[model samples]
Target: MAALPRQQHPDLLVGLETADDAGVYRLTPEIALIQTVDFFTPIVNDPYLFGQIAAANALSDVYAMGGKPLTAMNILCVSLKMVAKETLQAILTGGMDKIHEAGALLVGGHSVEDPELKYGLSVTGIVHPDRVLANSGARMGDALILTKPLGTGILATASKGRLATPEMEAGMAEVMRTLNRIPEDILIAGHIHAATDITGFGFFGHALEMARGSQVTMTLFASRIPILAAAREFALMGLIPAGSFANRRFCERHLQTAPGIDPLILDLLSDAQTNGGLLLAAAPQAAQGIVTRFQEEGCPAAALVGEITAPGKGIIRVEA
Candidate 1:
């Protein structure tokens, strides 16, 4: 995309340049529009639950950009012959449930017959022009907070291998279904310097993006990082997905691990995520307050996992 020449407009606040979660266009001095779209093949067995996860994942980009989702349009690709009519209806119904939960209207949708089943949404949201948050403004000494535990990628892989237990599958589903709406709204008005959702690229990958984009190094406390319950166990059992290994390789050259740090833990850190939570870089003075409020508002898993360091080689230090 960087090599491609595209016309630029002053009203376009964010486009492909920064690799931001969404496209932000300033409609007026007070209001900006956030647009993002995402869809993927079913990760869970139940079509309804799969729809819910896909919708949540799609809406997450808007939340990561500190925008209030106002509406969404469905994007579906299904194998009509292989899927029952009720299953398709259930999928749309599930997505509608989440759209409503986000207080967004389901305006319309598009569908196509395909060999594989898939679903998601194209979400449009609104945010104050002055409050638009990007993943590139993190500063030195800023504290990093992760609002959800990692491990969905590993658990999902385990499910395909028939290694994940029913409890574990349920847990992963619950995490994916939950939106980042709470933290996004709560911290957007706070001292947050930068933010990004931990999704396909994983925590380490996205954090690396933050650091590199801000021209700073980061030190993450391995012990302080939150992991999904049973995620480590699944990872230890070698249930990691192909994407996880790819993530590790993609970011390894830019990472520095302390001596004796467990390899398994590193693998979990690089584990690709689906519908993960927000990773916020907050000013030190406001970090604790924001975290306290997030937890008090029912986001108990939220934690201060790391901090930004002075500009350097964009290396991420993992300290045990």
Candidate 2:
């Protein structure tokens, strides 16, 4: 995309320049549209669960931009000869359930027959023109909060290798299918400076983007970072995904780790996530409260993980 000619327009509030979660376009003086699309092959065994996770992941980009999803269209690729009709229906039904849960309509969609099975959504959302949050607005001294535990990639690897127990598989699925929506009142009260959802790019990979975009340095507290139960164990057992290694390599030049920092923890931090949580940069005074509210509202893993230290060229400093 960087090699292609870019399109320019006055109403294109957020576009290719910043690598933001979604594109925002002004529709009127008071409203802007948030649009994003995401799709992936099955990460979990259950087709219904995979559909739910895929839709949730796509819809999260809008929420990261402080917008509410209004409509969604499915994107599916599957082999009619290989996949059962009942399985296909279950996947569509699963996606629809999440769309309805988000108070969004599944108006239409397009599908094509393919050898590999894949599914996701194209979502459109709305936000007030002035209230749009971009990942580049994080201010120095802002408290960073991560809303979900990490390690989905490792868990998925374990499942594929037949090393994960049934209980572990269920737990991983629950994390992936959970939506990243924060209540309007909570967002308004927190005074968020910036936000982005953690997805294919591992936690540090996304954090580097935020740091670079905001022109600020992030000092992360490694001990405070949330990790899913068994993620560390699996990672230690060499269950890390290839994407994790790629993410770490991409960010290593700008990453600073304190002496004695646990390699295992670093592995977890670099784990590629699917349908992960929001990484919010909130006003220092309100950050703890935001975490509390998120926990009370069913995000049990939400916590204050770090803070913006100073203006810098997208450097991240990790302390144990």
- List lDDT for all candidates, in order: 0.89, 0.92
Top-lDDT structure, candidate number: 2
Worst 10 residues of 1 by lDDT: 181-190
Query: Which runs of model 2 end up more than 4 angstroms from their true locations?
Result: none
Q: Best TM-score goes to which candidate? A: 2
Q: lDDT per residue, candidate 2, 219-301, as tens digits?
A: 99999999988898899899999999899888888989999999788788988999888999999999998999889876899
Clashing pairs in 2: none
At residue 17, candidate 1 shows an lDDT of 84
Tens digits of per-residue lDDT, candidate 1, 13-119, equal 88998878999999999999999999999999988899899999999999888889999999999888999999999999999999999999999999999988889
Model 2 earns a TM-score of 0.98
- TM-scores vs. true structure, each candidate: 0.96, 0.98
